[model samples]
Target chain A: MSRLAIHGRDLLLDRSARGPSWLVPSLEVSRGERIALCGPSGSGKSTLLSAFAGRLAARRGSLQVEGCELVGASEAVRRAHRLATMGQALQDAEMISYLSTVDNVLLPLRLAGRPVGAAQRARAHDLLARLGLSDRQHSRPSQLSHGERARVAIARALIAAPPLLLIDEPTASLDPASREAALDLLFSAEGTVVFATHDPGLIARVDRAFDASIWREP
Target chain B: MIVWHAAALACKGLAATPIRAVVVVFGLALAMGLPGMTVRTASHIEAVMVERAVRTPVLIAPRGSPFEVTLASLYFRGEAEPRVPFFVAAQAVTRGYGSAVPVLVGYRASGHPLVGTSADYFEARGLRPVQGRLPAVLGEVVVGAGLAAQAGIAVGDRLRSDRVRPYDLGTSQPVELRVVGVLGWSASPDDEVVHADLLTLRAIEGILHAHEPAGSEAAPGLGASVFLPVDLSPETLDRVHAHGALEELPVTAVLVFPPDDRRRDQALGDWADHPELQAVQPERVVSVLVELLVRVRDLLLAWSMIVSGCTLALIALVLALWRRLRERELALLRTLGASRSWIALLVAIEAGLLLGVALSLAAGFAWVAPVLLLGALG
Candidate 1:
């Protein structure tokens, strides 16, 4: 049996009819594969990524992630599975503004009620350093530049080394150098990657691409 | 381990908003501090009042409020009541029950009560001079330990009584008396008194006069002067006597000590029917006052508790608003796999840290307020 990270059959992308419908309803994501959901703005690329992360429930059809069926699972079970296996960076690069860069990276473990021992702290520091934020570890989100904040958010998502990573437009607002650096970090990350973006150049770097524009009514 | 991490995070979060945290902590401190200090001061006052009353067995005063008379005589609280004859002390002593010490509280020197009593007053109150000697002459006075230290007046220092109306021309002149001794601390109002003899008080009241020869013209009414010069010559002593028999002089109250329970009952029974006098057990009077104080303390405690509850509610409200404002942050935490319980625990820890700091500050304020207040008053 092939090990699949995401398996969907006739999965309705939106729970309400007010949103756009899916053009290609069947999809499969194999382990260690880099899949990009590409489309124009409002074409539902972020929505598909959110669905894969289990943030929104499918209106109908079968959906499974890492061999676990999520279509009818309880919210708690889905959340638990997401926390244990999935690392996600949303569009806003939502960082806890009051926390320092290192503390923000360690937030997932803290939220999981896991003991943040010296090893965990060192891991967080290493992640920040790898993201070119070693000197900015003690700085608050407000003190960091926009690119720096995006890097902090990415570092936070990957701190736990989840088996599956979900990133939403990770390099949309970054400059060319920062974008290349961010792409380098994302592709180098060890896991199954499903990211949402409209940048065709970024789409060419992934193993496979799913066009969300095909689902648009026009 | 999880709790500790959450607490550390909570502290960091609070440190991020230093001004808001300080405001919340200080609001809680005032909520707790004012009542804490009030209760402490009331407890101290009650203890001192009860101890003084227990040591003093009974009070004999002309018919009036027993509470007022007991306070005035035992605690030197100036209360105006009809004066009883000085012979009452001699009468009570002759009864062979126990000693009767006269207390005349009217004048004040340096804002401290000037108490005129016999030498037995010190013996009855178990007071001993820690410096110099007790007043042995009419022109001498003994200062309380606190009064001596506060006024910086030691043995041989001269103190003048404050006239009732300093600006009034017809009022008696202020009397100057020598401080012959300083009594030890008694932890009661007695430690704030200026102790003198009845003759000294009478002289200050201008009721004692010196006889002058018909040919002598020192001054017309000057012989009735209330001021006592530093030097008391033999002639001054001979002239300054009660205008009439000493027995006819008035006293404020007489502190009576019964030798035994039987004598106490006997004396109480003897004065039970007296139309113009009353013998009261001072402890009973003090207990009533203490009960009132206890009620007041309970009321204050209740108000403080209500204020504390309001403060807690306000904190919860603020936290709720804060939680709402941090929706994205919390949603991010949820996305990161934080359990709802963990979020709740983090909030609780934050509140606990804030309350702990506030209570510590309240305890400090409670400890310091009474000392500062009493010192300022003194």
Candidate 2:
């Protein structure tokens, strides 16, 4: 069985004529793998994650996620594929202040036009409990501690059990203990994780690391 | 189902800032409701005034504004309007032109107008007693059904007239009236007054009184010297008399119901040359008044439309600012894979719900405000 999660060749980032840009010559990720895109602050790590999520088009590439082409795909097609195959747990970006913790978890299903029935609610509760947020599931984002909010974002990304997860700086503003807990919960999710991170400890904990600084245009 | 889900989400978002939502809703409701209520209330007044005027063929009033005379006679308003002598009505009646019912208004019984008229006034107004017989004896009156209900008066109840100027020692004291009957509802001005014989009301006014006991000579003006006897025994009834001729006494106006167009024309012509009175076709006068009112209403309607436009623009501005504030939240929705149409639909649903509630509130208030206004007017 072919279980490829992401594939790319000549993946371009921010293709502007007179602006900073980069190109990833080749890349591949398998289902259930934990890979870190390691680089400095301006090394296009976040840009590559955005590209994998189909948020923006690449200038020239053969890019695919779970056998679906993304580089030249239409917006509708990209959206459907992304919703079906990927989940995101960006740092502080997915925390909608108006929604409660559990509602935020169920947001993905709502966006996908799927009914959030009893089973779905039970699954969300189970996921939140696994992430050690059972007591804070109904709390608004503003009422949550920073560490608790990060764990909630992870639970939201895992709620749909997508085959691929994209994360940006999951442990950016946390103490050592909170960082460890957040990584523990994230690593437990049943999907391939392609995360951008600057933490050396996290870089060492992942299954493999790709240095994105090598792909810089300079 | 998806639309309902979007609406629910929209509701949740609006609930996040309840004060803004409430302000927007009430502002919209008032903006939409005020004009509609004013138009409806004005139209209701016009319909009532025009209907009454169309029924009374001719009105004989002291030379003054015919509009004020019509208002005084038909609606019991214009208390300061000039009064025509009672002889004008009596002459019209005796000449066989048509029926003439003299009305002596401007007095009140328990805060309701005291309409002093005769049995012919009752017949001409198509008023029938619902509880008891029409007023027949001195010091007796028939109350309008609405007034009876509001004042908690019933047949046989004694209602004292409100003193016109209680502070003035020269004015007559209030006379206690016996409620002999309750007139049925006519949905007209007649339903809010106390009906009595013109002579009985004059007695209350100190114009007529019990004659000074045998040779104590009739005093000048009959002024408060003899308060109307509380109980009108047959002896006292016969003794009550005015010092001057009854024909010269004031009746606010005379409502003439001419049987046909020819008599109406004759009634108009008869008063054309009169020195102190003027005859008017109330229908024509009411038409001119209503036209003036309609013009004023049109101007008000235009003004209200401008106000409503401003209100709508304000609403749009508020919504725009609100949506701009929620741009981050909406972007999160977009990141969750919602389409542009989906986000647009959510915002639209929120605004649509607000407008719908405002429209419903405005309609309900518009429907009820006019009736309350007309009731207050009466």
Candidate 3:
């Protein structure tokens, strides 16, 4: 495994036509470490996370995930690397409305071209059980509560046992108890987690915290 | 694996919204099937009509609309006005033209037209009994297969002829004729008519009557109405006689069967100059009718094809809207590592499945529609 899960130097994130760009002077995250991107709203925390997920091309900077350059990589290369190594749970859980809870949790494996054998299924069931969603496995996304859908999304992200996890506002819709449980599940998994959030508790608990608000250009 | 996943996703999405799927399926089926059905039905009707018309080479009737004369004589469907004398056809036969079977079809029995003619009518038409002998006497009737089935009449059953003028005391009363035979299935209008001796139909028209008994006499001062016996036996048939000369008796038309085409042409030409009679080749009249039907069928086919095209466009629009509704979900899948090709595969599979089912149903409907139409026509 690469020691540096994510390495970057002077990265410029998302330069839109009408919006100001945000800059990261330097950043480094190690394998098995949990880092928090802390900032106010519109401070480019989410934009920086999108850059880390290889979804957005940085305007100017050197950025690499697990020793593979992503700053100027082709789309197919970035997508393949992301599918092989990274798991993402964006805001709102983003569950497919037509799929049931269990199927939604199994989507990552299906997309990765991985055969979802009994072992993978058992792991998915275990993750959902831990997240208090075993009873709702067969229920469609529309039938589940917002928090339950969030838990299903978390289960989906962890199903492939990806080496890097990128999450945005994972505990926003959860109550205190469910928040702690979700955090525990995420930290206990074997991977480096880089999450963007405004939660002080989450920032304090991470191995390192980077404030993105200062990088937001006026 | 990717293809399987895409297909499964598509099936699940269609099953999730069953109403839309069903609506699109049956709508497409109707749009595709209707044109084929209409074309087949029209063609079948034309073939049957043309075949029946070809069998009867010449028709001699009173001077009138040739089409009307042809239909009334061959199909017993319309009224041929100003009936001609039976002798007009018989005189042509006497001139070595061909045999003429007089058709007097102005009476009904059990809601079916009673076509009165000589025994030669059966020989001319190549009709045979499926159950018993053909009508050999005046009061005996031969029912067609279709009429027998519809009216529930069989050989040896008695059928009552409807009165021509029930309110007029001078008109003939209802008479009972014995069903001597049921004709075989001919797939023609003959299958729905009741064939009897011409004298029987003439009796029903009040042009002929039978006396009550040998000793019965009418009062000289008062003219009494003569009512024919309801049941005509050998005794009643002996007393039955025509009011006019036999040669002057009225016949609706005459179906002439010539030995060859030359004889048929000669017969038609011979009657061409007659003052009160007209000769028509049935095939020519029916061909014109068939051609008109073909035009109508082509128009309907074009219209239905347009409708099918519109239905296909509507279906495409519905699918586009469905994709729009699921746009966010697709983005979510992409974010979760599904490639663009996989999503394209899913949409293609869904559309292909719907088209396949619709086409299969359309084919099935096309195959069965003509039979149902022919049955309805009968």
Candidate 4:
């Protein structure tokens, strides 16, 4: 599996100009580790994940993802980089309410302007099969169970086979069995995965744990 | 393949969000209907104007707007009385410009119009009374089909004319006139008026003379009276003497027919330049009305364009933000190795397709609208 390196130095985030919390004071994660971000509530742990995903701007930091330094990169360049190498499974799932499960899975192919031939469809089917969710190929996200939803989300995230995958508390809605199943699926799959959560069960299963309270609120 | 995929995706997504589709459809329908109603109202006014244009060819009136003269003579919807000597009408007929007809109408019956014109009006349009006789005596009258429907008047029915004082704004006569004829249904413009002889109109004013103050050492006759339907050569018509007072005996207009071909063109061409007569093409007037209608429709089209632009912009903004909100979905798409331009293009094409559907529906509405209006008016 190819690795995704995340290196940020002295990142400051603010929702406003004058007074702002330091979302990530400093953080570094080299490639090839299943890292868990752990902290009490409101400690900028999620902001670190968001910064890695480029959903927000960090005031002061050098961010390098897979050796592409994005400290002063253009929005277009960042978008291309994200589209090519980053995979994010959101906390809220963000499933398109109208589209079916299979269409949703193939949307990345449609978005990338790649021909979705028989091979891509079969590959998607195989990925869905890994989560024991082959039957939900036509089911909407709403109709799926919590465990099934988590698996669908995982399949959607891993669909494009990105080098770095970012998942935010995938186990929040899942039972213990489902959480373990989701964790097993997330860690065993290829790539450098950075998942943030305080769940002890999930933390014990990771290769590294980062205590995230060291970042200061500006 | 790309367009088809976008269309399918748009339809599916819109189908999934049924409430949004319903809201948009209702909004568009309301936007189209309000302007359509305004256009239909204006068409009814133009229709009434078109009917009046067929009867009279030239109007001899005081220098005023042609619209006023046409309205006064044709539709009788406005002030139709034009102050010009009655001899002007007679001159046209006598000179072989066209046959002359005298029209005097400024009264209503139960909100329906009552016009006093000569039998020459019927001769001009080839209308023969299908019932009873034309207005012969002072109290005799003829009713039209629409007026009959509106007033419940029939042949032999004695309809009372509301009387006015001298110089009063009320109708001319107080006498109850008997309807001796009901005109046949012509399905044209003449189906809404009640016609009488020009003499009858003059006779009513003759009553006005009796109401005038009779002073000592004064002549006992009304000044310069009568709206006459005259016939003579232009040379003879020009020779006739006019009363010193120009306001009295004003003919609303004259419908003339020249006796010779060369004289007719000369007369028509001459009349177009004449100070007394306003020779207007009825078709041109109607064409102007049609042009006005086209302008109104063009204005409606412009407004529709504005609304469409606003709707498209709003939809684009909403869909763009919606895409943002659906980060997981896009992320899944991106993870599939999709290009950014491709995703944006799919969205753009989807919007274009929806606009196409709306335009087709608007066109269908525009086509169906006129026929429905005609049916309702008829």
Candidate 5:
């Protein structure tokens, strides 16, 4: 057993009656692998990332993450599995705008019905400090700069310390130096990382790369 | 515990939109306050009306509408009924059943009704003179506490009754009466009356006037005064007293107090079949009026309830629309691993808090409304 992080075969995702479909004949990723999904706009990169995160179901395929079947599984089972084993930073940076930075970071555990005790508070503070946002912990999301907001989103995704991490365009709005810094933090995180992006610089840092254009229908 | 967390989050969400939250809270307050204030005022009015009626035991008047007779006698409201002969009081007193006090209305002094009765009326009403003394002679009158303060009349001041048909050349003269005393406050219509003896009221009504002396300045058309002599000479008093007769005197109603329940029943039976008279229990007539008032209150209450129900429904619709607008925020929470039931609980908690604060404000308004209304009226 290679302890596969993700395994999919003959995956098909249809968009609309007249829209394009995403097709994957076969795909496999091993544990602790750093994989990048490289593509242009509307190349089905985000759709593929959504499928891997269990946010979207494959129309026809056997897809499994850490040996838990995703295809045809109930929504509740998929949601529980996602919450327990995966950390995802969505493309929209869906930070609760009213919550302070520190509370946003603690949201994952709170949502999971876990007690945010003293140790949890300490961990959240440490994560904010590591992301260079210790001074802005009490600032609301609206008060944060675009790059700071991106970093906060990253910190929130990593707070639960799940074994599998999925990120979508985490550095899309960052300056060159900030983008490099965010990428440094993402690559240095402890997990089997799967990210979707159009940046070749981010793709070059990954151990494996998949071109989403291959499966995108015209 | 989870609900508490949900409520805390809901509060934060509401606080984010301060103006919308305020609108919702005040809408609920008005919805609740309108009905609350109406019910409170109705209760006060009913209580006051019934209590005043209960104090007067019986009323004897000319054959007419019992409601009008009771209202005129006890509350001093509505048109004065046809006058009953003053001999009715003498008949009741001579029958050895109860004391009868005559009430004569139809005269006004400074917009206050000038009521004429005997000194026994004061004793029956448990009123005492806070100033001089009760009216003991024909030309003297006693003012109620409220009238004394309102009209700014004190002891030894002469107050003129308003002349009936003042513009008519043939109308009788207005009579002047001296204020002998001021009665204590009783918190009833009695406190607003200018009280006098029956002879004085007759003089004010122009039933009695001073005799003009021969070859004097008091000729009928020689710049004759509009007022009769208030301080009559002994000769004039003698002439006026000789002409006055008990059979011709009129009273609006006779307030009778039977010595016991047996005598009260006898008095009721004795007058029940009389062709020209009707004796009524003032309390019974007032109860009927209170029943009508209660029906009106119930109708008002039902209307208020419908308004309140509509307001609550409106609030619910607003909340539902707010929930629809917040779908994205809720979906984000779901993506963050919050359960569906937890989200529902959050919305419920927010609504409950808003209604709770609104209901409290309505209760406070209801408590204060009656006091303010009664104070203004009093």
Candidate 6:
């Protein structure tokens, strides 16, 4: 039921100090699938993820997630859909720092005003356990190793059962074995995943790949 | 469980910025504590004044200002005794009115002023002496609790009048007044006064009389001693005591214990007719002080409410901005399916928790401030 569909779109992201219209976009995504958005180092891989999460404006064309129109939605509704229906794992290390792993997993539920009961804890714990972090449930991201913290971030993004789990360069800091383990966990995720990474080995495992440079606007 | 999560979030956030938390708590305590202590002390004074008013049921003084007469006669708060027509007391009692006792309140024992009245002063208003017997003669004294403790005075100790004033400038009194009694605890205003009989008050007249200019003596009119008695009855007191004569000026004010309110009013009406006399109820004067105290408390309450509101507003504003800066945390919460309202609630809960701690600290400081003020005064 996670139809994380995207339609014709354009996006402008300042890739260099070069100019404001550095990267523009036209793109699409659908549910129960994994799309690896890839390009050379300066390509708009992360920008497409931001646009998919509705955190970035396309400047043209329509976009949607969990069957709801995302672009041009009210600021509140866009933020709501982004936090609630979409599971977003930032590739950047400067993610939410003050909260513990368990609290971080429950962030969307907290925003949704749902009771964070034993059931939610169990689900979050199982997700962390799958990421081989059963014992690190209460640790802060700062305390975890890069690989371990990336896995925890991925688990946190997926804990809410959102229609789309968006991950950005999750394997950038992972070692070979941990990177393969992270790929296995993502390839097996229940909902659709739209992730961007420079890793070619990681891409061969995904259901599909889109060269983000081809999707960019002129 | 939601509360637990909210508390966990607040603790994490506040723990990250301990300096901000400490400053907020410090500001709240200072804002709330100082004014509470000052207002509380003023309230205590008002309480004491109100208690004094009710406890002294009647007052007698020479007819001038009613409030001044009441204050001077009962509270030692103002000037000396006035010229009372001694014979008028006889008329008051004969007309089925109450018994009247005169109080001469301006003498001092060991530099602390004494209140002089009859044994009826203690009986009509039940005050017990803590030690030693009642004053048996002119030189005998009965000291109050405060007067005794403050001056280090005790029974049988002899004291001289330490008073040296321009009006009463003379050699210190040559009399040896014996402290025959010490009063028990009476936390009322009377605890601060030394008690003596009317004869002791008239004792001043004797010392001043002999010190008079040699040629200024008038008929040597029955030395001041002739006005005092060891065993005085109304009959013998009038017959032998010169000041109790038709001619001598009367004692300060007469406290009449009228048989009933009707007799009191009748006595009051009778006194009202005379140009030089008046009757007053301590109850009415006390009610006025009570009214004043209530007004003061209400005024303080309004100001305190304003301070409290400001403290809450500062707390709320700080928390709101802090939450805004912590949007990453809000995003994390939201990504976990937390609603906007839930995130706001966590922030609110954090504010309430900090407020609770701040209020407790301020209350503790407020309670301690009074003790510190009283200690400093002591």
Q: Judging by TM-score against the true structure, name the best candidate.
A: 2
Task: Give per-residue CA lDDT, model 4, range B268-375, as digits (tens).
Answer: 576576675566545456667668877887787678667756765676576567667667655654443445665566667655555555556655555566545543
User: What does candidate 1 score on TM?
Assistant: 0.82
* Model 1 alpha-carbon drift over 4 Å, by segment: A15-17, A21-24, A115-119, A215-218, B25-51, B126-159, B165-172, B175-187, B191-203, B206-248, B273-276, B286-316, B356-378
**How many residue pairs of model 4 clash at the backbone?**
16
Instruction: State how far residue B203 of model 6 sits from its true place (Å).
Output: 14
Model 6 lDDT per residue over B274-299, tens place? 77666777778767766886788778
Better of 1 and 6 by DockQ: 1
- Which residue pairs clash in candidate 5? none
lDDT agreement with native, every candidate:
0.81, 0.83, 0.83, 0.64, 0.80, 0.68
Per-residue CA lDDT of candidate 5, range B299-366, in tens?
Answer: 98899889988998898798789888888778877775576676778878888888898888889878
lDDT of 3 by residue, B1-378 (tens): 878778878898899888999898888788778788777778877888898889888888778678887878788887776387988777878978778888887689867788888998888888999999997777899999987887788998988889878798666778888999999988788888999998888777766676554334632343554455544676667667766587787788888888899999998998899898888899999999999998999998898888888987887787789789989988887777677787788888988888799889988888888766665665
Which scores higher on lDDT, 2 or 6? Answer: 2
Can you tell me which runs of candidate 6 are displaced by over 4 Å?
A1-28, A40-42, A93-98, A129-136, A139-151, A174-181, B1-57, B62-262, B265-378
lDDT of 1 by residue, B1-378 (tens): 668777888888889889988988888787778788888877877888899988778778778688778878887775856377888888888987699998888788766789899999999988999999998877789999888888788998888877756676453567778889999997778788899988887767666645454434643555453333323333467666555787677788888888888887787777778898888899999999999999998997788788877887787687678778878877877777676776778888888888899999999988887666666665
**Tens-digit lDDT string for candidate 2 (A98-190):** 778888898888777778889999999988787677799899999998778877777788888898999888888667766777788779878
lDDT of 1 by residue, A1-218 (tens): 45899999888766467756664467889999999998778888887877777777777788888767888877787788888888888888878878988899888787666778899889888877777778999998889887888888888888888879999888887788778877888888888999898887899999999887776554
The superposed Cα distance between candidate 4 and the true structure at residue B126, in angstroms, equals 15
State fnat for each of the candidate structures.
0.61, 0.35, 0.51, 0.33, 0.24, 0.39
Give the runs in model 2 whose Cα sits over 4 Å from its true position: A15-19, A173-185, B33-35, B80-83, B87-99, B110-112, B119-123, B126-160, B164-171, B177-188, B191-195, B211-248, B259-276, B372-378
In model 1, the number of clashes is 0
Could you give candidate 2's per-residue lDDT for residues B1-378 as a string of tens digits?
Answer: 457667768888888888999899988987899799879877987998899998999999888678777887898876744368888777898987788989888888877789888889988988999999998888899999888877788998988888866886554667778898999988788888899998888877777666444334444555435443434545567766678798787788988998999999999999998888889889999999899999998888888888988998898898889888888888777766777777778888988989898889899878988777777766
In model 1, chain B matches the true chain B with a TM-score of 0.78
Q: Report, to 2 decimal places, the DockQ of model 3.
A: 0.51
Clashing residue pairs, backbone N/CA/C < 3 A, model 3: none
